[model samples]
Target: MQFIDIKAIHAHSAAQIDAAVAQVFEHGRYINGPEVYELEATLGKFLGDSKPLHCIAVASGTMALEVALRALSIGPGDEVITTPFTWISTAETIALVGATPVFADIEPDTYNIDPKEVEKVITPKTKAIIPVDLFGQLPDYTALETIAEKHGLKIIEDAAQSFGAEQNARKAGTFGHVATTSFFPAKPLGGYGDGGAVFTADDQLAEDLRAVTNHGCKERESHYILGTNGRCDSLQAAIIQAKFANFRDAEIALRQKVGARYSEALKDYVTVPKIHPGNTHIYAQYTIRPKNRDSLGEALKAADIPSAVYYRKPLHQQEVFSHLPCAKKSFPHTEQAAQEVISLPFHPYLSEADQARIIATVVKAV
Candidate 1:
């Protein structure tokens, strides 16, 4: 068994994808073409925004975050409040922008950065709050927005794993000043290769992002500002457009159903994820904590059922960030969760039999 059935998904979308590639090859506009625009437009609608939000294509999710911070002029000496219970990319981007990443503790249940803890971490240097939507569930955005307003901080939703997530009747990307999603093959809405986009209600920020993605070029070759080569390739965009055409909603539905089965079957053996009220979980990983994570993962592997960890070390405890104030102090919850959480096989194509086999193996191991 596979960790995620990416091969099965590719098989299902092969014909449509071939056509998309053929069109791109025929046109020879392999840089940025109609396919790129179509992808941006289709995903904007899929995101379901009211005022025609903007989507700026980039090469990767880390590029999106770096550009967003650069657009806001957040750099050295500035701090971004965020939880440590996330992938290193969350803190890595903050540091790469020459800004300090302020650590905040997660709520033990939801594994989301606590807004109250965020408020405490904020100070005069706090320029942004980057609450990650870890494992495809939206964080407490309503509370986050309130905190943002109170502190006069820009909220950038680090939505790398939550492309289809929702909370309190609003989509994940629609919650903050801007949101970023990755198109790495493992994500809910992914591309054939490295791809990403930034979502924003502000038109000016979108324009800036577009230029930033292309070496600060305003047009084909007109340099405007210092920027990186972060443009999304047309081939990747074509694959994304093809995937968006038919399987987007169906895949989301399948994920929800599959996640429910995991919850029902595994709750007795482990601690399932806890989502806040009025929130929708997109089940990107469907991670749970077995008391003996490493042993359980090994047993599952021996049973031909693969399992992995979302993260091994919380950012606060990572050696690279140990000098920062927030990283210096203790974060018990984030530390504990990092050691126990294991992500089992999850994908739209995971069959009921596959799930049953996985569950049986896990129950037996635990």
Candidate 2:
């Protein structure tokens, strides 16, 4: 009945996690220990490239985004276009780096930022486009990359929700000028605590990201750029490595299977998730859009089945972004999605009995 079965996930890898943590404790190098580097290397291998992508582990997903912006020198007088339908961190990080966040409407079908809308928002001030991989599926990166190349803009792929996902055989973190993913325990390839990593193929940018995460020092006692304390703890890295062993081997396929079942059973009752061509989804949340979303939620609650909304209000309508021009602009798709989207209880380990119960409740309610 839980929204995400964290306990069940942990139980699946308890012994491996325990051993990893015990090793970290024995070494007592809690910050930036050997395990952190090992995890980063493992991550790089997971998201393969002809030349291995450099992965810089950081304190959290927010830090990874901020570091990416800072390394790219995107600041005041610059604008970053991103979807307003995602978690606040996607846009807020742009604002935090002294850049304006220009809102782009999402595609109703994918609930991902519309590349067409992105093109419309580009002004002289536009420096980068942050395409978020919403609900564990990538946005139209091929189109976005073409746009970025035409305009000479950077693309920062926000893959926090789609770490294990794939598009055209390329992994989630392999797109964009630089990409970032979260390990917030709830993510597909998550750690025991808050953590994230930045990915890039450019050697210089990789070096810059490493420095940015470590007080701007390439070596001890020398500061090259303005930076913050954004280092990931060794303990978190160890936990992620342990879990990743299983996550890559079996958990991703299990998630895909569960997601397919939900879509197959619920498609007639509601708007099930739409998997774009050439993309493989991990279903971080099995979200659906039902006309009577609120009523359906009530019915599920009455039936003792759990459900939740990913975002009840689009970022354009949020009070914090009111001063921005986009805050006043109408985004029909984003607004409609806010009113209709609801996520059912989902996890790789969701029992068949639980899945059936959830589907029956939803079908009846809708």
Candidate 3:
């Protein structure tokens, strides 16, 4: 009945969470505490340990992107290319860091930033590319990496929605020069409160990230760069660590099954999310496009079923970005997708009967 069923999720992990929190209370080190480092180490091992990826936990996903940009030295007079169809924070991070956010169109099928459109936007000032892993699926990083190497641009994987996804054999967070993910309560690997982390195999970059997130302190007495208070709370990290141990893998598998059920039942009535070859989608939002998106939403509402739109407007059309330059002359696909996509209630805890009811309502609506 709920959109994401967070209560059901917490019910499964409540005991483990209480234990973790009790340990936190016993120690009483709230900021950048032991639990935070434990979570980071666990995440590093989960992603890969061959090069031993460094994980830097932060206060929020937006702050993760901001810190990554700063560590990479991307700032004023530099241009960073990213998609126009994502949450505003993706592009806003670039502008906030004093860089220009160059908008690129997305692939109609996957709703990912088109690599071809990215090449057309490169100029002498272009510095980095932030390819968002939208809707729990990753962009074509192999193609994006080729483009970055040829132009000497840094690639930052905006993996806010894809913490548990994979491309080929590489985990989503291991794709670009540095990748970031959110722990917002609705995300696949969410925590109790706002949280995020940056991942990298580069040792020097890891050092910079740790320093920048901690008031730009290379050491307690030495301040070297401009930074912010971006450390992930100890309690949030403990809760997430507990949740991951209890149900993360099982939940990921359940998401795939749920996404497939939605696609099989609804593909005839609307456009289902497309998974590129060699990629595994985690279904953060099982978005679909119908010709009559608004009407379909109303019809489902009338049936006591809820539906929501992931994005109703592209960043290019937003008034705040009117002053920025765009990479493409037109975002035809991005604009078209905005009017057609809607998401039904999707959570791992949904019963088959509930899923069937949702499907029946959607089929009847469309």
- The lDDT leader among the candidates is 2
lDDT of 2 at 58: 98
CA lDDT of every candidate: 0.86, 0.93, 0.90
Model 3 agreement with the true structure over 183-263: per-residue lDDT tens digits: 999998888889999999999999998888998898886889877788999999999999986555698888888999889
Residue 328 shift from truth in candidate 2, angstroms: 1.1
TM for every model, in the order presented, reads 0.96, 0.99, 0.98
Model 2, span 1-366: residue lDDT tens = 788999999999999999999999999999989999999999998887566789999999999999999999999999999999999999899999899999989999999999999999999999999999999999999999999999999999999999999999999999999999999988888787899999999999999999999889999989998788999999999999989988989899999999999999999989999999999999888899988998999999999988889888889888989999989899999999998999999899999999999999999988
> How many clashes (backbone N, Cα, C below 3 Å) per candidate?
0, 0, 0
Residue pairs with backbone overlap in model 1: none
Error of 3 at 175 (Å): 0.9
Least lDDT summed over 10 consecutive residues: which range in candidate 1? 44-53
Model 3 Cα shift for residue 125 (angstroms): 0.6
Candidate 1 global lDDT: 0.86
